[model samples]
Target: MSGSRLGPEWVPGPDGLLSRHAARVILLDPSGRVLLVRGHDADEPERSWWFTVGGGLEPGESPRAAAVRETAEETGLELRPEQLEGPVLTRSAIFDFFRVTCRQEEQFFLARLAGGTATELSDAGWTAGEREVLDEMRWWDVAELEAELAGGAVVYPSNLPALVRSLLTGWDGSCAHLGEVEE
Candidate 1:
C-alpha cells in the first residue's frame, strides 16, 4: 500500500487507505483555548452554539478528507490533522469492535486543527467565558467536559462531547490534562 493512491471509493484505490464513511469533529487549539462553531446558519440565536466543525461522509470520501474539509468550511482553517483514532458510532455495542458480537455500529473520525482560519468567520472565534448560544466559546479544561458528562449536558446530535473527549484522550493522554492552545 506504500505507493498506492486512494480514489473516492471504498475499494482502496492504490494507497491502501480504508474506504469507510465517517464524521469528524475538528478541535482548534488556540493559545490556551479551543475553537468551536455555534449553530449552522439557521439554528436559534443561531449558529455555532456548543459545537465543532463536522459533517457526514460523502460518497467515496474518507473520514480524514471529511475532517479537513469541515475545518475549512466551518472554521476556514487550512490545516491537516496531527493524528487521530478513527471512530465508528453504531448500535453494534462498543464491545463488538473488540471481536465479540454486536448489532450495528456507525463510524466517525476526529482530528484537531492547530493553526489556520477561514479568513472570514461566520461568527467564528474562541471562548473564554460563556455565551447565550454556547455559554461561551470556552477553551474548556478536561474537567469541564467530564463535568458536562456527569451532568448530562450533551444533548446535541452534532455535538459529541464525550466522543470528542475520547478522541482527544487517544491523541494526547487524558482529556483532563489537555492543554488549551489558541492561535
Candidate 2:
C-alpha cells in the first residue's frame, strides 16, 4: 500500500449505483471511549458527518489488513492484525461524497488501545484531501455520541452505540450483518 492512495474505488453495482467495499474500526481506549472522525463533503462543507476510523480496502486486501492499515493511516495508531477483535458488525449504506453517490459495504472491528487517549492523534498522518474534509477527531463515550445523534449530527452505522455495547459484552466470534442504513 502506498501512502498516497487511500481513496475509495467507485465501481458500479447491480442497482446501477457506484459501490465500494470498506473497512472501519471502532477504536477504543481504556475508558471505553471510541474514536470518531468529523468531516463533511469536500464540495459541501455544511454536510458534515462523523464515522469510525477506517477506509476503503485496496484491491485484494483482506478486511483485517485494511482495518490495520486504515487505523494506522487515519488515527496514527498502528495495530497488529491479531489485536483487532470480531468485525463484530457490518453495515451497508448509500452515501454521497464529492458529488458521487456510492453504495458502501463496511465491516467494523473492535480494537483497544491501552492507556491511549485522543491527544495522541495529530494532523501529520492525514492525506491532504482528508485534512480538507476532516475538521477534527475525538474520543466519544456512548452518551456523548448518542447526544450528537439526537442533536442532529450524523454518525454512520446508526446503531453504533448499541453495536459498541454489544462488543463490550463479548462476542461468540460470529459477525452479524446489521442490515442497511436507509438513505
Candidate 3:
C-alpha cells in the first residue's frame, strides 16, 4: 500500500469520524471588504485557493477563544472574544491533507474593524507549517470575489458572496448552518 491515505490518522471517535473542529473569522474592514488568505496544499502547490482565516481548535479551547487567538496569530490583530459575533456560519467538509482524508467542522465568527485595524502580518507570527503553505493574505471586495467565482477560481465555504452580503445587512445573532462543502 502507498504511505498516503485519504483519511485522518487517528481512529474514528464516537462521532464515527476522525472529527476536527475549527474556528474561522470573517474579518471585515471599515469599507466592508472581507479578508481571505491565499494558500495551497503543501503537497500540491498548483491547487491554490482562497479561504477564510482559521485552524483546528486546541484542546479545551472554545470556538470563540480559538477564533480570537487564530485571528491574532494569522493577521496580527488582537481581539477580545466578546468582539466576535455569531458562529455566523458553520460548515462541514471532508478533504485530503497531510496524508489523510479528514472531516472538519468549522465555525465562522464575524468581526468588523475600523479602517486600519490589522497590522502587517509579517513572518514573525506564522507557524512554521503555515509559513510554508500560506502564500498571501488579501482583503477582497464582494465584486472581486464574484468575478473570481465567475471566472472559475476556487473559493471555500461555497456561497461566499451570499454569506458576506448577509453579514453586511446585519447578523441576526443566530448560527446559520451552511451544510457541507467540498474542498
Candidate 4:
C-alpha cells in the first residue's frame, strides 16, 4: 500500500484507506451522564451520528494528551492529561467522512467532570473543519442513550450504551479491545 499523506495524522494504509490513531473521551458528568457530540458527514450532510468526544492525535502527542486536548476542543471541558483514566477501551473503526474512507485506531479514556453539574459547552475551540461537520453537543443518561440507539439513531462504537454502563460501574484496571467496527 502507498503511504501518502492526507493530513498530518492521516496516512494511506492497506487497501488504500486513510489511517490514523485517535484518542477519545467518554466524559461523564457528576450525575453519570456521558457527553456526546452529533456530527454529519461532510460529503453527505444528511448522514449524521452521535459519538464520544475525540479526534486524531497530533504528532508526538500521547493518547492521554490527545484525549485531554480533544475533549477541550470539542466540548470546552479542560482536563489535565493526568486526570484521564485508563484508555479503558480500544477499537479500530473504518468509516466515510468528508468523502474519504478512513481506518482509525482509537483509544477511549474515562473522565469525570471535576466539580459541577453544569453541562453548558463552548464551541469557541472547534477547528474550522470541526465546525463544518459537528453541530450538537449534549450530555446523555445511559438509559436515554439506549432508548435512542434502540430507536435507530446512529451512534458510533455501536455498543456505546453497554460500554458506558460498564464504565459507570468502575474500570477493572484492564483495557478492553472492542475489535473492528466498519460503517
Candidate 5:
C-alpha cells in the first residue's frame, strides 16, 4: 500500500492507518472576546458551550484548507490567509484516541475576522441540524467563557480557550504572534 496521509505533514501509527491532522480556527473580536458556535449535538434544555468556528482536514488537504472549509461551512465566512494563527496541538482521531486512552485533540489555530454580524446560512447541517442544530451563535468574554467551562457546559480538547486566555493575558490586542504545544 503506497499511499500518503492527508495534510502537508504526515505521521504513521503502528496500525499503518495514517494519522490524520486537522486544524481549527478561533477568531477573536475587538473587545478581546472570542467567537464560538453552539454545537448542534446537545438535546438537553441547555446548549453546548460556544465553539470556535472550523472543521476537519480532508484528504490531501492542508490544515489551513480544513480551517477554511470548516469556517465557511459553520459560519459562511470566508477567511483569507492573513487571518490564521498557530497550529496549537495535533491530536488523535476519536476512535483511536479512546483506543489509546487519550482523547483526540485537534490542532488549534488563532484567527482574526473582521467584526460584524455573521451571515447565517444553509440549514445548520452538522453543527446545527436545520437552524436548530446551531442553536445560536454568541461571543463570550474570557471570564464568561471560563465560567461555562467551569460549570461543565462545554466540551474538552477545547483546553484551548484556557490557553488562549493565558496567551492573551495582559495583551493590548495588537499582537499577532501565537505560541504552541507540539504533538
Candidate 6:
C-alpha cells in the first residue's frame, strides 16, 4: 500500500472505502484565469492530472476554515475566510491515487487576488507529501483550459471549464451539487 493513505485524514467509511472531506479553492486572477496544480499519484508518476489547490479538512475544522488554510498552505496566499465567496460548487469524487481507492466529498470556494497584478505564488508551505505528488502550478484562462481538456488533458471535476465560465459571470448565491464524478 502507498504511504499516501496512511494519514489520519483518510478514514474508512461504512462501505469500506477510504473517505475524506475536502475544501478546495478556485483561486482566480484579475483577468479571470484560475490557478491549478499538476500532480501524479505517488505510485503512478506516469499518470498526471490538473487539479485545484486544497486538501482534506482537519479534524473539527469548518469547511470555510479549511478552504482558507488550504489556500495558504498550497499557494502561500493568505486569505481570510470572509474573502472567499460561496462554496460555489460541491461534488463527490471517487478515484484511485497512490494505489488506494478513495472517495472524497469536496466543497469549492472562489477567491480572487486583491490587486490587478498577479500575486506570485509560493510552494514553500507545501507538505512533504504534496511536494512529492504536485510538481507544477499555473494560472489558466478558461478558453485555454477548455482546449486542453478537449485535447485530452486530465482535469478534475471534468466540468471545470463550464463551471468557471458560470462563476466568472457570477454565482447565483446557491451551492450547486455536481453529484458523483468518476475520475
On TM-score, the leading prediction is: 6
Clash tally, candidates in order: 33, 0, 2, 0, 4, 0
Per-residue lDDT for 37-149 in model 5, tens only? 77533344343445566655667877777887777777666777657766644455443221222122366677654558453444333532324545666667778877887
Candidate 2 vs 5: which has more TM-score = 2
Across 1-183, the per-residue lDDT of candidate 6 in tens digits comes to 213454778888888888889999998888889999999988988999999999999989999999999988898888889889989999999898878888999999999776655468999999887888999899999999999999989888888888899988777898889887778
Query: Which residue pairs overlap in candidate 6's backbone?
Result: none
- Give the alpha-carbon lDDT of every model: 0.41, 0.81, 0.80, 0.87, 0.56, 0.88
The lDDT ranking, best first, is 6, 4, 2, 3, 5, 1
Model 4: lDDT of residue 173: 90
lDDT, candidate 6, equals 0.88
If scored against the real structure, what TM-score would every candidate get?
0.43, 0.88, 0.87, 0.93, 0.61, 0.95
**Model 2 worst lDDT run, 10 consecutive residues:** 1-10
Off by over 4 Å in 4: 1-6
lDDT-better candidate, 3 vs 6: 6
Model 2, range 1-183, lDDT digits (tens) per residue? Answer: 113232546667788877788899998888888889998887887898888988888899999999999888887877899989978888888776777666889899888877743448765778888888889899999999999899998887778888777776566798889666665
Cα error, residue 9 of model 5, in Å, equals 17
Weakest lDDT window of 10 consecutive positions for candidate 5:
95-104
Model 5 lDDT at residue 24: 70
- lDDT of model 6, residue 73: 89
Local accuracy of candidate 3 as per-residue lDDT tens digits, 1-183: 122232222345465656578899998888888889988888877888898988878778899999998988888878898889998989888776654566788999999886666545644578777877889998899989999989988888768778998898779988888676657
Cα lDDT tens digits, model 4, 118-160, are 6689899998778888899989999999999889899988888
Best by lDDT: 6
Ranking by TM-score: 6, 4, 2, 3, 5, 1
**Winner by lDDT between candidate 5 and candidate 1:** 5
